[model samples]
Target chain A: AQSVSQHNHHVILSEAASLELGCNYSYGGTVNLFWYVQYPGQHLQLLLKYFSGDPLVKGIKGFEAEFIKSKFSFNLRKPSVQWSDTAEYFCAVNEGAAGNKLTFGGGTRVLVKP
Target chain B: SAVISQKPSRDICQRGTSLTIQCQVDSQVTMMFWYRQQPGQSLTLIATANQGSEATYESGFVIDKFPISRPNLTFSTLTVSNMSPEDSSIYLCSVPGQGRGYTFGSGTRLTVV
Candidate 1:
């Protein structure tokens, strides 16, 4: 069975601070990676995704994530954070070619203080 | 990305009652799935809503508890039978699109008393 792990439970940062959320999955086969964001009282929205050909993938809202295959990690990052960036972030993974099922991490709650 | 919508965004029901949640897709899709998100827990896949056939449930879930119906490619429904307080959570419907990514609905938040 494949599972995803989010190293942090909660993250608090001041505005303009750098952000990094670590994500790792237990899977040996080729996989697709994604990051989704959920603002307060809103639906989860896709931030970015990695299918192939790129280790570093850029997403909406100034967010980006790097797929480090050797490390089995896909970490979400941003150079500076804003108060509006406060939300819960989830990292998900799906197995190779014909895979349609997604395994999601426990999720990290991000709080950006002004 | 396909737009998905779920009805009864939030609901409160009695323990013995049942609630049917509806999921509508803007366009026809080949795959639709239902998921549950318990408080502070990772989202769990409930079942794959199969078109014109019975749903395929995941481990720890069954049709007796969660009956699903996919009448067409663009719409589906999930019913929580004999609800309990433990069943209180957000129910989300998702559609698989290009790149193996999924588009999720706003989610239906259910609270059983």
Candidate 2:
């Protein structure tokens, strides 16, 4: 069985402040990492994913994440955040290559204050 | 983009009753998945809905409890039979993305009282 852990349960930041949310997964085999964001009253949307290739992947809204295999982490970062970024973010992992099952982290609720 | 639409955005149901949530996709997809999200929790996969075949349920989930239907590529349904207070959660359907990502429905908020 595989599991994901998010270090932060809640994060508070001011507008224009840099942001970083930690995500780590426990799986011995090859894994696929993903970050999904759910805004208030909205469905979950993909922020970015790391399937293969570049360790650093860029996503929408100037957000990016780096996959550090040694650390077993794929932390999401943004140079600057806006008040609109207030949402709940989740880290997910696919246990293996073939199956589509995704094990998700507990989630981090970020509040960006203006 | 693969668009997915789900019905009955939110509902309040009595315990021991059943609620069927519907999902419709704009394009044909090989796989449709059903997921359950408890309040303020991560998404947990309930089962895989494959067209023309029985659903593949994950560990701790059974067919009779969470019966699913996938009549075609673009349509699927999940029925929560004999619901209980513990069954109160959000039910969502997802389709495989072109890049192997997933496009999820808005989710059905099920509250069993």
Candidate 3:
């Protein structure tokens, strides 16, 4: 079975501050990585995904993640964050290309202060 | 992206009762899934509803507890039967959107008391 681990349970940042959220997954074979964000009272939306090719994947809203195969990590990063970025973020992994059953991590609650 | 409409956004039900949540997609999709999100936890997949066949449940889930129906390509329903306080969680349905990304519905908040 595939499992995801998010090191940070909660994160707080001031406006204009840089942000990074660590995500690691345990799966032996080919895997697809994804990042999702859910704002207050909104549905979960996909931030970005990494299926193949370049490990550095860019997502919406000035967010990006680098998939380091050796590290088994796909950490989300943003040079500058805004108050509007306050939301709950999730890291998910699909074990193989056969199915879409995603295993998600314990989410990270991001609170951006003005 | 396929748009999904879910009914009874939130409901309060007494123990031993049942709640059936419906999900209707705007367009046809090949795969539709149901998930549960407990308070302060991540999304846990309940089952995979296959059209014209029985649903495939995960390890901890069973058909009698979470009976699902996928009558067609774009619609599915999940029923939380004989609800208990432990069943108090947000239920959501999802499908593959553009670029094989996931598109989730606004979850149904089920409160079993």
Candidate 2 lDDT tens digits, A1-114 = 788999999999999999999999999778889999999888999999989899999999989999999999999999999999999999999866544778899999999999
Tens digit of lDDT per residue, candidate 3, span A1-114? 789999999999899999999999999788889999989888899999999899999999999999999899999999999999999999999877644778899999999999
Candidate 1 DockQ category? medium
Clashing pairs in 3: none
Over the stretch B1-113, how does candidate 2's per-residue lDDT look in tens digits? Answer: 69999998999999999999999999998889899999988899999988888899999999899999999999999999999999999999988787768789999999999
Model 1 Cα lDDT, one tens digit per residue, A1-114: 999999999999999999999999999889999999989889899999998987999999999999999999999999999999999999999888643778889999999999
* Alpha-carbon lDDT of model 2: 0.92
Share of native interface contacts present in candidate 1: 0.51
Those runs of model 1 whose alpha carbons end farther than 4 Å from true positions after fitting are none
Q: Could you tell me how far off, in angstroms, the CA of residue B57 lies in candidate 3 after the best superposition?
A: 1.1
List per-model TM-scores for chain B: 0.97, 0.97, 0.98
Native interface contacts kept by each candidate, as a fraction: 0.51, 0.60, 0.57
Candidate 2: which stretches are off by over 4 Å? A96-99
Comparing only chain A of model 3 with the true chain A, what is the TM-score? 0.97
lDDT of each: 0.92, 0.92, 0.92
Per-candidate TM vs. native?
0.96, 0.94, 0.96
DockQ of model 3 vs. true complex:
0.65
